[model samples]
Each structure stands twice: as C-alpha cells, then as structure tokens.
Target: MISACGRDNVGSKNTAQASHSSADAATRTIQTVKGKVQIPAHPKRILTDYYAGELLSVGGHVIGAAPLEFTNPFLKDKLKGAVDVGDPINVEKALALKPDLIVTDSDKNYDQLCKIAPTLYIPYGTAHNIDETVHLFSRIVGQTKPGERLLAEYREKAAAGRKALKGVVAPGATAGLYEITDKGDLWVFGPNWGRGGQAIYNALKFKLPPKLAASNKQYLQLSLEALPQYAADYMFLTSYDPEHKGTALKNLRQSPVWKDLPAVKEHRVFYNDFNTFYPYDPISITKQIDLFVDMLKQNAKENKPGQGQGR
Candidate 1:
C-alpha cells in the first residue's frame, strides 16, 4: 500500500511539471524593426502610436493610441473608448494605461515607451505595399490566419474594381493625383504614396504623365508654375484642410495654367474628400476602389474619347 501511494504522488508531480513547461513555451521572442522583443503569448492591452488603422483592419485590439484625430477618422466611432495618449504620446499617460505591448513607427518616443512597456518600433514607410503592413501586424499579434484572410479580401476587391472600370476607362488612359494644403502648397504622389496611388496606379493600372513619372519619390512638392507639366487625361484633386473652405481649390481655378490643362478643360477632375481618400490601409483602400470606379463611369459618360486636348 505504501509503494502504491508513492507511485501516485510521482505521477502527479510529473503532470504539473509538463503543464508549466508548455506555458513557458507559449511566450515567444519576436524580432521587430527596432530590435528583438519578448512578448506575452497573448497581449490584451495594446498601445499603438500610429498604424491603428492597420491594426483595426486585422481585428487587433488597440487599447491606447496617439494622434487619434488624424489617423483613425474612418473608425473613430469604434475607438470611442480608447485612451488618447496625445500626439508624440505622453509617457505618464501611456504608463498609466499599463499596456502589455506598445507599437510605433516613430523613434522619437521609443525609449520613453519602452520604459513603460515592451515597446516595438516599426520603421516608417516599411509597409508601403499595404500587404506587407497587414502581414507584419498579424505576425506581431499572432493572428497569421486572419491576416491572410484579410489580404485575400483586399485582393478580391481590387480585382473587382478593375473589372468594373474596364468599360469606363480605356487602356493607357493617364491620370494625375494632387493635394493642395491650406498654405497653398501643391503635392503630387507616386505609386506608393498614401493618396490612392496603390489603387489608381497598381490595381487599376492607370498611366502617369511623363513629367510626373520621372521620379520614384512617394510624393513631390511642386510650384504652381510646374502644375501644367503634370497634366493628364483625368485629375483627382483634394485639399488637406477641411475648414479652409475651398480656398486652395478656388485659387487653382483662377490660374490660367490650371484652366488650360486638358483634365480641367474636359471637366474630368474629381474633387475627393481628404479623410476618405488619403489613407492607404485596407479599410480605406476598399472604399477608394469603389469611389474611383464610380467616378470613372461618370467621367466616361460625360466626356467621350478625343473630347479632351491631350486625347
């Protein structure tokens, strides 16, 4: 009887040891843009200085964020309860949140955030390809399957957008995308910039004018004098400041150079809202594709081929 009791006790001890070992293996060491970070098996309270849109797209939990007014406008309502840590992020406020993990693209506040928690700094423009951003976010949160599913969904939507605009826009048709600041600065974007370039140039395969196509920079700041050189068959124009009340657009319309542009003369310019069309994340991309297809259809109906000077 004594021997049997000793055997039972040994079996229980081994089982408990095995369980503890499994739990330890669950936690992993991951390599981030900044360096290596050991994260919990499941992080509940996550703080993101930026890339909130990308996190939300993949269904990651974001308990805290900074610059909420700017990056998360599309899903602001959903993040109503999230703690706004301030633009540049307040270290005191962030620590008070007691986050499990903190993610950011800026290194300015990296040391401060690291002291508060296990912070991961993802370099700026690392995810210019959108798919890379989604995959990276998924791997960080241990949601690889969901990330793949979300990417598939985005691909399907992009394909559908191309099909929808097939009859509306002819092959080889060129387009120019530009944004004007309240201070009267003109900005043009390239294929990887946030201004619907992925959807316009990559997905829909629109051509850029020769002058604008020369450089590979995400965006170029140009003067009013140079605007005529970037003219194309169609134009997508927007203003950054919502309260500026069309002052920039008004000024551009007054310019003789702008009026003489082929897109303007043919009335093929589509004025877009900054908030809806500027972001390059999964959510914004979906909306941009739909809006772009509709705009092309409308332009095709109103203006036929050879109606514009360039055509």
Candidate 2:
C-alpha cells in the first residue's frame, strides 16, 4: 500500500508541472505604447483604465474600468457589472480584481499600475482618429479581425451620413460647435476633440471658416463678444453641465451679438445633450453622425429667404 501511494504522488507532481508549462507557453510578448508585455493568449479579465469604449468596440472582455460613468450611453447598459476603478485608477481595487491584463492612459500613475498587473499605457488623444485608436487597442488584445470589421461598419455609416446630408445642407455651407461651461466659459471644438468634430469636419465633410481653420488644437476658449467672427451657416450649442437648465443658452439667445448671427437668425442653432456628444469613440461617432444628419434635415426645412445669408 505504501509503495502504491508514493507512485500516485509522483504522477500528480508531474501533471502539475506540465499544466504550469502549458500556461507559460500560452503567453506571448506584444509591444504596447509604453513597452513590451507578455500577455495571455486570450485575456479573459481585462482592466482598461481608459478608452473602455474602444476596448469594447473590438470585443475585449473588460472586467473593470475607470471613468466608468463616461462610457457611451449606448454601451452603458452592456457594462452593468463593470467595477469603477476611479478616474486616475484605484490601484488597490485593481489589484483586488486580479486582472490578467490592465490597459491605462499615460497618466502619472502608469508605473504604479504596472506594479499591480501586466499594464499597457495608451494615452488619451494619442491617436489622431477613431479608426487608428480602435486598431491599436485591437492589436494589443489580439482582436484585429473584429477591429477591422468595426472600422468597416463605421466607414459605411459615415458614407451614408454624407450622402444624406448632401441634399439637405447647401453648397459652401459651414458648421461650428461650441459648449458653455457651468461657470459660463465658452469653448470651441475642432477636429481632434470629442465634440463631434471628427464626424462633422472629417466624415460629413463640413467646411470650417478660415479663422477656425488656422489651428489644429482640439479645443479653443472663446469670448462671447467674439462669437460673430466664428459664426457658421449652422451651429451646435450645448452646455457643459446637462442639468443647468439652459441658463447659458438662454443668455446667448438674448444677447444682441448672438441674435445677429446668421445661424441664430435662421434658427440654425441646434442644442444637443452633453453626454451624447462628449465621447469621440467609434460608438459615439456613429451616434453623432445620426444626430447630425437628422438635425440638418430638420433645419433645412426651416431655412427661410435671407436666412443664413449674413457674413
């Protein structure tokens, strides 16, 4: 009996060793924005400190995320059980989750997250366009095929939007977007920002005036008095604080400078929800395109003689 027990114990030890070897062999080294990391063949539990939308777009199995509330509303219902790891990321909570891989923005806590798990640093605004950002994240998580499909779908939607808007928007027409903060500061969004700039200026092929076209910055602070100089044939206005009761919009509508602008006189200024238009990811861009096309069609019917004719 003693000899038989010893042989059984030896066999169990060899089996354990073989299982560990298999696990080690399943991992492969992949280069990240920060450096190379050995990740599992399929990362089942992923912790994305930022760009949760982009990760989900490529079908990443995200277990935890940061800035959880900022995820696009369309995907919010899908992330019902995702843990909120805090904006800068709560390392202790992240460690408790025991994720197979962690993806974070290039924030100050990059090194700290690396200590907790196999982390990859992908900074926000690093990619120039949504497709580039999606592709990069997909490659990191070994979902390149899904990423390509997502990109193709996005392109199809954009092309359809352009076709729909062509008949509604007049030739040589321009569009502008601005947001008023709760503190009453005015800001403008460009092609790089999350405020529908990519969909409006790039995908939909809208024109930007010479003054607003001079810079490549994502956002620019503006004064209310100078609103006329940057006015376009159509304008989108929304408040930074969604629950503010439209105080800023009210003030702008009452102002002589704002009332005199062509878009305002023509009733071409459209109001949008802060949450819907704030994210510039693939999902959000798709929604923004839909909203833009719908609004343009409605506004075109309201266009009157001598409306949107001013400089």
Candidate 3:
C-alpha cells in the first residue's frame, strides 16, 4: 500500500509538468520591461487607448476606447456601437471591461496595464515625427500584409496622389499653416512641429519659407497685428473651434500689412476641417492631399482669367 501511494504522487506530479509544458508551447509570449505577455491564439476583446478609429478601419473590433471631452466626428460617426472607457487615466472603467488585449500609445502604464492583460505598447511618435506611428499601427492592424503586398499597394496610392498634385500647386506659390489658440495666439507650423504640416508638405511639395530651414525648424511667432509675415501665395488655417472662423479671418483681413500680402490680397486663405487636416496613416494623408490639390486647381482657374490681362 505504501509503494502504491508513492507511485500515485509521482504520476500526479508528472501530469502537472506535462500540462504546463503544453500550455507554454501553445501560447506566444513576448518579453518586455513589465514582464512576459502571452498572446492568445485568438484574441476577442480589444481595448485601445488611442487610434481606436484607425483600428476599426483596418478590420479590428475594439470593445472599448479612451474617452474624449468632445467626440471626433470622424470617429463618432463610425464607432457608434463602441463603449467609451472614460479616458486614459480611467483605471476603474478600463478594468471593468476585462479585455483580452490592451493597446496603448506607448510603454506608459506598462506595469499596471500588463497586470490587466497582455498589452502592446505602440509608439505614436512625437508631434514632429509620425514614421513610428504609421509603421507600428500598420503592423498591429496587419496593414503590412503577406509578403509586404499591402504596403506596396498603399505606396502606389501615395505616389499617385503626389503625381496628381504636381499639376495643381502653382509654380512659385508659398503656403503656411496656422494652429489657433484660445488666447488668440497663432502657433505657426514648421517642418518639425506637427505631423499635419510635415505630411502636407510631403504631399504638396509647396515652397517653404526660408525660415523653416533655420535652426528653430519652426516659423516666426507674431501677434494678430503681425499676421502679414505669415501670408504667402497660399495659406491653410486650422482651429479647434468653429467660433474661431470669424476671429481668424477677421484678424488677418483687418491687419494693414496682412491685407496687402499676396496671399491675403488674393483671398487665398483656405480653412480646413480641423480634424481631417492632420493624418495618422498614409491613407489619411492621401485624402488630405486630394483636398489640397482640388483647392489649388480652383485657385488656378479663378486666377487664369486675369493672368496677363492687366487689372
């Protein structure tokens, strides 16, 4: 009887070891500073901290998304069915969902998030750089594709958009972008400041002010009274609020120097949908390029009748 009891205990121990080994083999685990994160063979519930809209467009269904003070029309219209988990700092709400995987903007909250579920920290890049943002999201959502086919296809689309834009942006035309603030201070864009400006410049190939090439990599700052310095052949203005329309346009028009600038003189200041003006991925950029090209075409048409005709 004593021998039989010892054999049973050994057999039970062997069975436990074998079960653990099989489980380890079946799961895919990634090591990070937070520890090991195991990826389930099939993940069903997904929660995203940012870029929830991008994930949905790429065929992933998210159960929860970070809350916003105001809904993004682009996201609100499409994700009517998704639940808002309040915000990035809303731990209680996020915990209630019991997600299978959590996707965040970076390694922030790594320790806490890893404890909740296997988390993938995607780098969205800084305001000046979006290469990391585009690439990371592409991989997570499977935009890279089999044999890099999807990437090739997306590249083709971007190339085509650039080609189409070449015919429209007039020779010698210069442009500037502005971000309006509540204090009425205009944060002029530069090559290294915002993703919107960088992507726009990449697509339109517009002539940039010499100041953009300086060490600052940012354009000159000015009071509303000094708006003339920013006026050029073409100007794109962006604001977070609809109310800024009257104020932004009025400020530029009333300034004596601003009113005399070539772009302002020609009424070339175009307001953009504050949200669509920026992009997170190539597809978003392509859409904005199409809008810019159309604007340039219209400007050319309106100016054609007076060209070389004299006033």
Candidate 4:
C-alpha cells in the first residue's frame, strides 16, 4: 500500500518561495465602509460586486466582478480575464478565483467573503457623484495619481465639448432618460443614476424636466399613462431588449398616451439598449461625453426646428 507523500522534498523550492512571498508581501491599512482593515499593498486579483469600472480605470487587475460591469461595452475590453461572480456575488465562485481582495456594495455574505480574502464593503450611493467615486476607488487601490489624471482629462473633454456644441443644441433643452424593464416597469432616471444620466445632465449640462429636477430623487417610477405629464425636449428610453421587438416597447407604443407626447410626436426620442450606457463609471463617462455631443449635433442637423427629435 502506498503512503501519502509529505512536503519534505517534493517541490520544496516552490513551497519555500510561496512561504517567502506570503511572509514578505507588503500590506496597508485603510478605513473602509466596514471599518479599518489591512490588505495587500498592491492587490493583483480583485473581485467586486459593483463599481468595477472605477477600479478598472486606475489600472486595477480585476479577476472577477458582477454582471453589470461585464456588460458595459466601454469596459468589456478592459475586463479580459474577469467573470461575473453574480450580482449579489457567489462566494464559492469568488473563492475559486483566489482573489487577493474583494469589494462589494452589499453586506450580504460579508463574513463568508472575508474567509476567502480581505473584503471591503462599500454600499451603493456611497459617493455623491462619479468624480468622487473615481477618487474613492483610486484611493482604495493606491492609484490616486492616475485617478487625478483621468479626472483632468474628463473635465478637459467636457470643456471642449461645451464649446463645440455652442449654439448647436437648443438652449435650455431638457432631456429625459427612461427605462422599460422586461416586466414593463417604467423608470425615469435622476441626475445621479447611471444610464447616461450623468453624462447628459452633469458632463453635458442638459436639464431635466422642472418637476423631475425638483423632486431630487434617484429614480421616479411612472405608469405609461402618466408619461405625458412630464415631457421634455428629448427623451432616451433604455430597454432590456432595445434591438429586438420586445414586448415592453410594443406595449408602450400601443398606448395612445405615449404617442401624444411632444417629444414623441416630434420624433425626438431614442430607443437604446439597457447595457448601452449602463455604466456611469469615470472612464465610461469620458467616452459617453463624446457620444452625447455627436448624437445631439446629429439630431440638430437631421430634424428641422419643431419637426424631428429636438427643436
């Protein structure tokens, strides 16, 4: 009968090296939403439940993240080896990656995640805006310098965009962002939420309807029949099945209430996929500014005043 081999001689060098690496690995302590915790000085494999895009912009080595981060086209190329661990995050899948650090926006399974690696808890709406979020993530990854550079670049682009779009788009033009879920739920995004709201309202300086702006809320749920009550100059309707002939879109169109809106009547509405501009991360925001400028410019050129999408 064979006996189990011991660690006396088999791959001794590798074992020694691994022990040395563990013992010599540098660490740093920082205050997190869950209190202070020490982590690797430079994390190599990070799995996050949300805001994965913020870390990616600062040259983070993300190994796994949630499904939303993987779906954004702007971030897809940067996430080469990353997989979606799950929205709430599957601890088993997270452990399989052997992540050096884990960041999550929820407290569910916090203890379980800590067993796999040094975990940092960051709740949703922790930062007031995307710029603050970039600063937050950069500090978390010890990438503050690069984060500063990215913010400067984003601001510079917005400045140039503001000048280029001068007198092109209608002044005081309000753009309303809406979403139709697979379940036919209608949502209006506030300034802080993603789905291109930050790009359109903050970076581009567009206005929301007076009522939506006054409410100061994250999202406003509205029935299809109530849509006409808060119409704007332009509308961006993001849906789960943007390209396909989805039931939500069909149902919305069938309602005479939708057809009577001024923005709809003038064809100043765009139907976009949910993932198209879902990520409001700094990197995505930078790219989105360029897309918004072009889209608004094209809308102005294509439609005559009070004719097509936007006057």
Candidate 5:
C-alpha cells in the first residue's frame, strides 16, 4: 500500500510541472522602456494608462484604461467593455480584472503594476508622430499586419485630404493655431503640438508664415495684443475652459483685437471645440483631417471671389 501511494504522488507532481512548463511556453518576450518583459503572446486582457485608442486601433482587447481614455470620441464604441480606472489608476481594480498585460505611459506605480502582471512601460512621446504611434502599439500587441493595414488607410485618407487642401492653402496663405484660456491668456501652437497641428501642418501641409515659422517653440505663451504677430492667414482657435464658463472665448469675440485681425476680417478664422482635436491619436487625427478640409474648402480663397484676389 505504501509503494502504491508513493507512485501516485510522483505522478501528480509530474503533471503539475508539465502544466507550469506549458504556461511558460505560451509567453513571449518584448522590450520596453524598462527592459525585456515576458508577456502572454496572446494577452487576454490589456490595461493601458493612456493611449487606449491607439491600442484599440490595432485591434487589441482592452479591459482597463484611464478614465479620460474612455471619453475619446474616436474610440468610444470600441471601448465599450473597458473599465475606467480613475485619474490615477485603481491598482486594486486592475488586479481584480486579472489583466495578462499592463501598459502605462509613466513609470509611476510600475513596481505595483508588475506585481499584478507583466507591465510594459512606454514613456510618452516615444513615438514622434501619430503614424509611428500606431505602428508602435501594433508591434506591442503583436498585430503588425493589422497595424500596417490601419496605417495604409490613414495615409490614403490623409493623401486625399491633402490633395483637396492644396488649392485652399496657396503660397503665402498660412495656417496658425491658437487657444484662449479661461484665465484670459492667449497661446500659440507649432506644427507638432496636439491642437489640430496634425491636420494643419502634417496633413494639409500649409505654408507657415515667416513670423510663426521661425519661432522654435512647439507652443508658446503670448499676450492677446501679440495675436497678430503670430497669426497666420488661416487662424485656428480653441478655448481652454476647464474650471469656468466659456466667457474668455465670448470676450475674445467681443474684443476689437480679435475682430480686427486679417483672418477674422476675411472670415478665415476657424473655432474648434477643445475636445475635438485635443486627443493626439491616429483615429482622432484622421477625423481632424476631414474637419480641417471641410473648413478650408468652404472658405477657400478661390471659392470666395474678391476675398484673396490680390494676394
């Protein structure tokens, strides 16, 4: 009886070891900002601190994400099953979800996150632009083929929009983006900043006027009076209204300085809602291309006679 019992115990131990080995084999290694991490090759649940839209675009299954990420219009429907883990991620909830892979923009709580699962840390701005952002996420999810398809589609849309915008954004006809804060401060944006820059500078390929082009800043602080100094022929404006009613935007419209600008005088100024172009994702950027093209087409110099005839 003792010999029979010993044989059964050994068989059970061998089966457990085989199962553990199989589980280990199912995982694959990938390099992140924190170095190499072995993650499930087909992760069943993915949790991201930010860029949920970027992940979803590559067809990755997201289970937990940042609260604001849930609000992205471009990713709204696709994130139906995702959990909003609050402003700072709710680590307890993340663990409860049993996410096989965790991805975050910052290294904050990385040790904690890793305790829950294999965490992939990606520092913000790791990808210089939206296309690279898409490709990077695709590689992270092991969906490179789908990522290539999505990128090609984006390029096709961008190409079509850029072709249509060629005549509108003629030589010397520049586009500059600016924002008015609830505190009544005025700010200007460069080609790489999040505010419609992807569409204006990247997609439409507008001619940046001399004054606005020479400044080396991505975005800058300037007084309301200095608006014209940095203003382009086509002005794109947005208002920052986090804690107040939209009185600053109203006041800017009422101000003589705003009304006196050439872009305003010629009806070349376009006001964008803060949420529309604020998301710096490929999906949101693609939507922005259409929005920008429509605005330019409706107000294109040639479309309106005597508007820019002399220029």
Candidate 6:
C-alpha cells in the first residue's frame, strides 16, 4: 500500500496533526434538512465511516475510514494519525470515539450510529451526485452556500468535459461493465437503470448490448467458457486493481477464453477505477468519465479513422 501520509494522498487523514481542529466542546452546530448537528466547529478529531469521499470533497478530513473502505492515493497519503474505524455497520469501534458528529448514508445502521454521535444520513446519491452531495454535506458542515457553488462548478466542468469527448468517441460502440472476482466469477453490467454502469452510461450516453436490457439490478453470470458471447465493442474491465501491477490483470490474461475474446484480441479492453465502478457515486462517475476520455483519446491515436466507435 502507498504511504498514507505522503503528499500524494489528496485526501489528508492527519486529524491528530490537523493545522486547525477542535474538540467536541469547541465545535460548532450545523442545521440541516435532517436536523441540527453539533460538530466541533473545526474538529481536529473527526471520524469518518462510509462517506469518506463525501467528506473529503467538502474539505472534511477523516480520523478514521473502514478497513475495507477504500480511499485513493491522494487520500491515503494525507491520512496521518488516522484510524481504520472498521466498516460503517461496525458499532463497537464507532462508539468508542464518542465523536461529535458522524457522516454517512441512510443505508447504514443509523440507529446504532446515532447512539455513538449526532449521526447525519445524506442517503447514497448524496455522496455520489456532484451538487446534491456537496450541498448536503456542506450544510452538515455549516457551510451550505459554498458547497452549492462547488457542486455547480463540478457540473459545469462535467458538462464541458462530456461535450469535449462527444465527437471523439465513435458512434454505436456497445460497451459492457465486467465485474471480475478473485474466484473467477464474471458479472456483466446491464442497462442504465442504476449502479455504476448506469451512472457511466448516463454521463456519457454510452450504448449497451441488447442482451443486457433485461439484466438490470442483477449480475449476469458468465463462466470462463462463455466469455466471448458477452464481448462488446469495448469492455470496461472494472473491480480490479491496476496498481497491483499485473496481479488481477495477470490472472485474467491467463484465462484461455478471456484471452481469445474479440475485444481482447483487438486490444479494446480498458481497466476502470474499481472503487467507484462497483457501487458508484457522482464523483466516482465523473472521475470515471474523465478516465474514459483519457483512454479513448489514447485509443484514437493508435486506431485508423473509421475504427473508432460510440453509441
């Protein structure tokens, strides 16, 4: 793992070494749609659970993130004195902090978290949506208007970014989101109903394979033997770590059928940020789009004019 306190960790976790942070008695009170939540006006000893990304976007540093709760390289480096608070549902460690305020989505065990601190539930999309999440979280932090503005800027950027990639992407290129497991299980993402695949398709308006229309909200199983049938113009290889430097990728490459797919043969497979692709949020979605554009642009450089695709 990358050093958690290095300059590269964009999301800083140095709660103990915070330039400015206060204890519960010195915190400020924030009023929100849910209710008033008293926070250490400028808490130095903050604890985060499920919504670390949400908090990071709103300038909130985490003293804790769940063990499995992944953070990017930027966040990993800055989290000094940070503790792995366990998963969002783990009430035991969460209660020990006696945190002034806890931020999370509604899907978590709110009742238990509430007992530990003045918990704030913003729902799943709030952390995912560009504006809604920032606005809601900023309000919880007692700085609503700024959060609103930031979200607006993000939307503007997202729109501009999408428009920039429109013409560059080829038309009618069917795409699929592949969920690969350590156990060799394969799950294909369906149409744009919900989930990361939907979020990705929604932002860029990418086309889906016809067979995926009825495959919403569920994983479509594919054995190694049947990998070729589901191959599309482009396969968004997700849920794997590229940093492992050929760890999972090496395993996938060794699959006999996986190595023989048309997309693989054509070198049309691209790795995606696994963290966001599994269960997505707007920030993750936008980030993924940006990545897609980067990869697409790279692909364009090598392909003949008529070889590109989109849908």
Encode model 2's per-residue lDDT on 86-196: one tens digit a residue: 878887888898888787765567666666666666666767787777766776566678778878887888899888977788777888888888778888888778778
Weakest 10 consecutive residues of candidate 1 by summed lDDT: 11-20
Highest TM-score, which number?
4
* Tens-place lDDT digits, model 6, residues 143-253: 455455546655665676567766766776777778776555677866332235644565566777656754544357777677676678778876554445555556777
Candidate 5 clashing pairs, residues 3+ apart or interchain: none
Candidate with the larger lDDT of 1 and 3: 1
Give the clashing residue pairs of candidate 3, or none: none
lDDT of 3: 0.55
**Which runs of model 1 end up more than 4 angstroms from their true locations?**
1-24, 68-73, 242-245, 304-311
lDDT of 4 by residue, 1-311 (tens): 01111112232121001111243457655465455556667888889987688888876788898887877888888887788899788989997999888878888988788888877777667776768777677766766677888888889988888877898877788989888887899988877788888788888888998778888887899988777766688898888664465888789867888888877787788776577677778888888888888877887778786566532
| TM-scores for all predictions | 0.84, 0.84, 0.69, 0.86, 0.83, 0.66
lDDT of each candidate versus the true structure: 0.72, 0.72, 0.55, 0.76, 0.73, 0.58
Tens-digit lDDT string for candidate 5 (1-311):
11111111121110001111243677665555455566666677899878687787787899989877766677888889788876466779888998888888877777777888877777666776777787677766766776777778778878999788775677556888889999989988876667878777877778665676787677888888887788788888888897759898889989998888888877788888787867777777778888888878876744464564211
- Best-fitting candidate, scored by lDDT: 4
Worst 10 residues of 6 by lDDT: 12-21
Q: Give the alpha carbon lDDT tens digit for every residue of 1-311 in model 3.
A: 11111111121110001111245554344332233345443456778776675555455567788664125544666566667875563556667887776767655565566667667654443323334344444444433442144345445655676677565666555777776654466757764444256555754567665444443556556676556655556777766565555665556447676556666556576766666764444345435556676776676666564352101
Residue pairs with backbone atoms closer than 3 Å in model 2 (clashes): none
- The candidates, ranked best first by TM-score, are 4, 1, 2, 5, 3, 6
Candidate 4, residue 293: Cα displacement in angstroms equals 1.2
